[model samples]
Target: MTKRELIDNIARDGLVERLVANVCHRRHRSLPDLVQMVYEVLLNYDEEKLMRIHRRGAINFFIVRIIENLYFSRTSPYYRQIRRFAQHSDILKDE
Candidate 1:
């Protein structure tokens, strides 16, 4: 299927909203980049992977996988800092 078709399928299945909200929640209240991330992930889906996600239940599961991959692929010091901050947020919250 075409990239446009995949994106349309994802949006129509309500996965986009779910993924964006999930990313926002998990990424320490960050939502601004969630849509762009999803777009990138969906556009890069390989044929086998795309078929798997499509068969399972559209793009919802695929979005989950993308988020997982992104979290693990954090080579940037920025994401590392966010993770560190997130880990220590409870104590900082009372300050």
Candidate 2:
């Protein structure tokens, strides 16, 4: 599959949303932002490489890693944009 096709498949299946929900359960309010960030990161990859990863049955793993890193890594864009601004009480509230 091409980049567009793979992205369409992910979107059609709501893979990003599900992955974000599962991986960022404590940060539920960031769901939409995380999903969008995942897509942005995926969009930067080479299409042929993405297709190869998909063909190897590692696409889900790949996406999940992206979600995990984005939500958990302090240096990640997700942290810089969303997580950093979240107050401690807000995080506790989500939990």
RMSD of 1: 4.2
Residue 78 CA displacement from its true place in model 1, Å: 8.0
Candidate 1: tens digits of C-alpha lDDT, residues 39-72: 6767766867776777677556667766665554
Model 2 C-alpha lDDT per residue in residues 32-83, reported as the tens digit of each score: 9989999999999888889899999999999999998988899999888888
Of candidate 2, the 10-residue stretch with the lowest lDDT total is: 22-31
Residue clash pairs of candidate 1? none
Per-model C-alpha RMSD: 4.2, 3.0
lDDT of 1: 0.63
> Best-fitting candidate, measured by lDDT?
2
Flag clash pairs in model 2: none
